[model samples]
Target: MKSHIAALLLATSAVFPALAQTLAVKTSAPERYVVKKGDTLWDISSLYLNSPWKWPALWQWNPQINNPHLIYPGDVLSLHYDSEGNPRLSLAKGVRRLSPQVRVVSDKNQAIPTLPLAVMEPFMRFEQAMGESDFDQLPMVLGSNFNYKMNIEGHLLYVKGDLPRGGNYGIYRKGDAYRDPDNGAILAYESILVGTGRVVRTGNIEAGKPSTVKIESVRREVKPSDVLMPISSGQSYSANFKMTQPVQAISGNIIASSNKLREFSTMAVVVIDLGRKDDLHEGNVLAIHRQSPTVIEKESGPSYIEDASSLDKVITQVSEWFGEENDEDSVVWHMPKEQVGELMLFKVYDNISYAMVTKTRQPVRVGDSVSSR
Candidate 1:
């Protein structure tokens, strides 16, 4: 067993140069640090470098350690330099596994999440994008028991549609219409999650029989005309947060955000225009860029003297007073791109994606440009 561990460490160290080269370490980085629970790779990497995205380049994995990429509580990491003077990070001490084994593990306890999943989970769970034709034929709540205006827990709901038998459904309400950023055309509609309920009994939609659903839970007040959708079980929105490098180059704009705020910070979920069609996938890292304000140079000139001696001059002055001024020749300079924050795509659709802010050097705002290149 001792020999096996030694061999594993020797092999990992042998290939360190190619992987560790080009990785820049912060001037004030610590030589050694102890890993703690709830610590993400980004968080730990930020402690050692100015750019946390370069973590994979510097991370040196040990085959002897089980889940070496996942640094658990009480583990220690040390910084070292290879023969070529490249900075390399190594797991000095951590949990050990002699051999590889496959087993089921709960992400809640076993995995180190890329970010605070709780804050972003609610925004992702039922936020789905669908076309107008798809939503037009969806199941909708007709009326609750005794035609109640608002439905709550333990209330019976009558819905109009052919609901699946013996399965649960997520109750949703139609939200703000999502228009394309590039154009004004409607790309998809947003479904706002209200609650979860099971179809207690199904009825024939062809014969005008409304399905009966008993409310199992409630978040907002479920009401008539609310849409019912099948619960998402293993979809992209339900996947665990896994931090990874950007797989493809992407560029888009922030269209919306959680809480409908104009600006947000780390741990907040923001909606981007890029999606699966753009080759984005869950765990793909994207950088948020804030463009500096456009600069327009104005030449200094003396104010023109207005003379009322002529009727034509008086008419020109009147037009100038009420008319709008256009800066036709002012020099407009393009602002340099500044990376402000990094987000990990957790849920992606055809034309949209939901990403949580993992790191931010500046405040994230709506209309900010995002890219993976």
Candidate 2:
């Protein structure tokens, strides 16, 4: 019994020393870290942690860092120490220290970075700034006695003399026509028609005399006996007002021919009436139309929705060409070797040849009749 007790006491003394040594090592463990300039928490975390993304975990441990963005120069980092003096990350503020600035150097020569051409290709292809030479030259019908009316505010106007009213009238605010009393042949229309105005109030004034009229906002000119009517109101009329500018028209068939061929696709390409003579230039858009395609939806099982199918090819691109005046067989400039889908002529040639597509649910095609929609 005495020997056993003595052995037990010796064992206890040995275990106590080992445990005390571990406690002393833990108490004296150092976890101080210095912060370096240009060094981010991310870099530091990446150096210490297995994953750089684990920086957020370190940030959460540090209550001083309210946000990732809060980290700045001179911030210290602290890690906890185990009994074995091993470094362990912790949120405790007392464990970390601030250090000196860290430096990073590049080994390779740095070259100025430039954007690749492919990156800018789309912008270079942008057709927004294209010229409209042909459209400026095309002959456009001004408000004639046949097509348009003029109105001042909301009132209509009537012209005096034997002139015909209610036709396409160039709504000028000031100028008028003088009739020869002897022969009554239509006299000269005024050259200095000041402004384009609509005739709102239409009534008969004495021949060769000025009539009471609510002309369009300003004073211009009115052809005596000119067709005077109120301008149509609303968006369509507004669009028409803008359409007073001349545009090109597509002529001939939009099909593939060996002689006049340009580009060809499963679709068609039509010839534009305006060309170099008409001042038509490259990158002009022409609208084409065909019959509207039929759409049908298919049926699947109870839980599934079926897909819808459509018939007919759509208009795609427009190419330009020039033809000899007397020689119908001559070819000027064909864009594609064969005709493909027709293009909408949003652009114009120098001859004032230009147009826009109707862009309707029904597809437009060659010979379908295209006007400024």
In order of appearance, the predictions have TM-scores of 0.76, 0.18
Per-residue error (Å), model 2, residue 139: 23
CA lDDT of each prediction against the hidden true structure: 0.72, 0.32
Give the RMSD in angstroms, all C-alphas superposed, for model 1.
8.4
lDDT of 1: 0.72
The worst-scoring run of ten residues by lDDT in candidate 1 lies at 300-309
Report the backbone clash tally of model 1.
0
Query: lDDT per residue, candidate 1, 1-373, as tens digits?
Result: 4475456446534534443455689988888776655666667878987666566567776654665456655556789988888788887755332326532222433545556656756766666777777777889899988667988999989999877666689998877766677886675677888898999888788999999999999998898888888875565533344345555566888888876887788888888888888877887778899887544333643223332225434544464587744345333344588988888888888888888887788789988899974
Q: Clashing residue pairs in candidate 1, if any?
A: none
Q: Which stretches of model 1 miss by more than 4 angstroms?
A: 1-21, 65-68, 94-109, 164-166, 232-249, 301-330
How many clashes in each candidate?
A: 0, 84
